[model samples]
Target: MNTAAPALEMTGLTKSFGTMRALDEVDLVVEAGTVHCVLGENGAGKSTLCHVVGGSLVPDEGGLRLYGSPYAPRRPADALAAGIAMVHQHFSLVPTLTVGENLRLLRLKNLPRRVARVRDEYGLDLDLGARVSELPVGVRQRAEIVKALLREPRLLVLDEPTGVLGPAETDALLATCRRIADSGHAVVLVTHKLGEVARAGDAATVLRGGRVSGGGPLAELPPERLVPLMIGRPADSLDAGLAGTIGLAADEGVRETGGEAPEAGASGGRREASGPAPRALRLRDVSVRRPDGTTALDGVCLDVGHGEIVGIAGVEGNGQSELMALLGGSLAPAAGRVELGGRNVTRAAPRERSRAGLGVVPEDRLHEGCVPPLRVADNLFLGRLERFRRYGVLLDRRAMDRAAESVLTEHGIRAGGPGALMSSLSGGNQQKVVLARELALDPLICLAAAQPTRGLDIGAVGAVHSRIRGAAASGTGVLVVSSELSELLVLCDRITVAYRGKLLGPVDPAEPDARERIGALMLGAHAPDSGAESAVRTAAES
Candidate 1:
């Protein structure tokens, strides 16, 4: 090891919030010109550690040395001046400003020239003139990375950077990490994806319950060795054989490849249907248009039978958002019918749809899923406060709190209490709260979840998958829209590719060539009925 004074070193670092110790006597070291991955489940103190390093949260104990020099930052600006930059899990860009304008906030001269140079150098293509709010999550993430890179810091910290990215985008980001490391910079990559660690990490540190559990170089510590440290149990103990069945282990090659080859009856080992189940949701010739009159979804015909999990897969900005909005009752279709439990509810209001047994987990949980300023209990009953009403006027706060407490415990959510602010919880716990609230709706006809596991840890992923599968087993049709193809492959019985606002084949995940076919279809290739099948066959032969 060519170790010439480590890039960063910490000893006895500790941080706490209220009575909770978010970080406890944590010790970490990062050598220059290397990529170090920080692995942990949500609430495992990964974000807290990052905050401490990035100068967001001051550690209550211990000290840090940067390049063998005393390094203590009072604020993010101080950290930036000291050659440290951080890209947060949630974006930090001003939503109303254009990308170019946001870059200007960094005090760079000749904004267009600098942006173009960095964009070309890092392969981060962003529309500088576009408003931050108008961009999709993936694009916005790219913008954040670009902004961080423009700072040209000696140390860079990225938290859950690939959580919202597609497979291709994820690959590109990994490459960028490698490039940065090769240029003699140090990178701290905080992620839950074992595949990413295997691909990009040189060394790693695993944290459990605010303390260092285990860590080493990636070569010596593979994913198998890290799993137990992360969740305090072997991978096999996860619900539904999640770790093995879903291919979360790096050795399974599922991460490198999109997913595992299909097994017999590959509905993720779910029970086979005895007969034709009643339809839970149906979209017949459904079409939607953007406010500017462009087609967002065109003639999309789809069906989700009771007790089935259907997945929608595509690159972002390819109609997935519009489809979710249509199903969630936030957007009206320009044409066609939307049927839920065999009842047409295309024109129904959002609350009406919810009352009719439709549960929606929106993509942006922070903004759309819950009210941050509200208590966890209040958020749990949001949009359905009438359920907790006493008589027809006064709110029954006690009943709401009790029910919320039960839901939190049942869903395995860790929070201060029912009275805790929703904003105070970690990304994973917040998602669990949303899931608990939506899934708790009895007589639920259909559940629509968009990017349900985004920014969540492996443990949380297994829990979300178990919940979805359980919902399907209970005769609730589940529609999962995700940018992660591997996630869809492992979770859905049927997968459809969306391209240019059009729906393609609902291919079986059990098929041998399913992954290849899905990839082809996502790139606008024709389905099997068209001439594209022969093209794929020929390409394989060659």
Candidate 2:
């Protein structure tokens, strides 16, 4: 072992919120020139640890040492001064500002020269003149990383950095992490995916229920040994084949095809030979234009059958967002029709669509899905206040609380109670709450979920998959949009690729080269066959 002093050391770290203790007697160490991974389920104190290190939160009790010197930071600026930088899961950039302008806000000098130098050095290709709000989530992630790298800190903390990235972008970020470590700095990667640990982690620390469960060099501890520590169970006990879906079997050289789609009669399975399955959602020659009058989706045609789950796969900014928005009734199509449950909902409001048995789990849960400042019960019953109205004007708070309590228990959401603020729950639990609310609609005819499992741990991913499958089993047509192809391959019955603005292929996941075919389609490598396009349009119209 090298005898040099470690880059960072924490002893007996603890943090609490009201009656809840987020972190308890935690200890950690990071050696320079190595990538250290922090692994845990959501609410397992990982984000709290990152916040404490980044100076967003101060530990109630702890002692920290930086290169053998006592260190403490009261704010993010102080942490930056001490050579610490953090890239958050949610970006910190001003949405209206350009990348260069955001950098200028950091008070950096030599704007043009330094921005270009850092961008080149870190292989971060960002459009410095582009407004953050106009960029895709993937591009926003790159901007955040670039901002962190520009500081040239001695230690870097990245929290769920790959949650919004595509496969190529994820690979690039891992390579960049390796480069940073090789440059004699310490890097902390907070993530839920085990494949990433195998790919980039030099060492790891596992947290369970806010305490260190197990940790060691990656070489010494394989994924099998780490799985139980992270989720309190053997790898084989994961929900069906989810061990491979979330990469828990990655270190064992498990192939991507190990997790197959559910068998017949299971989720994503076809209905028994009862003629043709009823159509739950259909889009005929649908077209949508952005505010700037640019086409976002052009002449898209699709159909989702009841008891069927269809997936949409593509690189970010390929009209997936617009498609979801159009379905959710937030954006109107320039031409064509959207039918839910065989009724035209072309100009319906979100509430009208909801009443028509449509449920939506939006991609950006924090912003579009729920209100953080409200109580969990209020958020759970949002937009459906009439159901609990006592006198047509007064909300029946007791009834709402009772219903929320049952949902919390049924969904296994960890929160203080229905009265707790939505902001206090962890990301995974927040997502679960959103899902439970949407799925609770008695006659939910169709469900549209976007990036449903992003940033979730192995256990949470399995739970989410099970819930979505349950929805499909109950005869709800499901549409999922995700960047993770592995997830789509396992969860979807038919997969479609979005390129430019057109929809291509209802490829069967059971196809031998399904992943390869979908990848090629995503890149627009070959023009879609005319026959296939005709067949899709026929299915939608029929």
Which number leads on lDDT? 2
**C-alpha lDDT (0 to 100) for residue 234 of candidate 2:** 76
Q: Residue-wise lDDT of candidate 1 within 1-542, one digit each (tens)?
A: 23478889999999988999989999999889999999998888999888889998899999998988888887888789888989988789999999888988899767678677777887788888788875667788899998998877789999989877777888888998898889888999998887788889999999998999999898998676788888887754543235533336534422332344333222445432224444788787788887657777777777777787888888887888788888888889989899988899999998888888889998878877889999999989877788888789999999999999898888888888899999888888888888888887767999999989887777788778878988987888888989887778778877888787787876777778988999998888874343222121111122
Root mean square deviation (Cα) for candidate 2:
3.0
Candidate 1: C-alpha RMSD after superposition = 4.9
Clashing pairs in 1: none
Query: Candidate 2's C-alpha lDDT?
Result: 0.82
Candidate 2 lDDT, 438-534, residue by residue in tens = 9988689999999999878888888888888888888888889999888887788778888877887767777889889999988877745442352
Candidate 1 regions with alpha-carbon error over 4 angstroms = 1-3, 236-241, 244-278, 527-542
Q: What is the lDDT of residue 99 in candidate 1?
A: 88
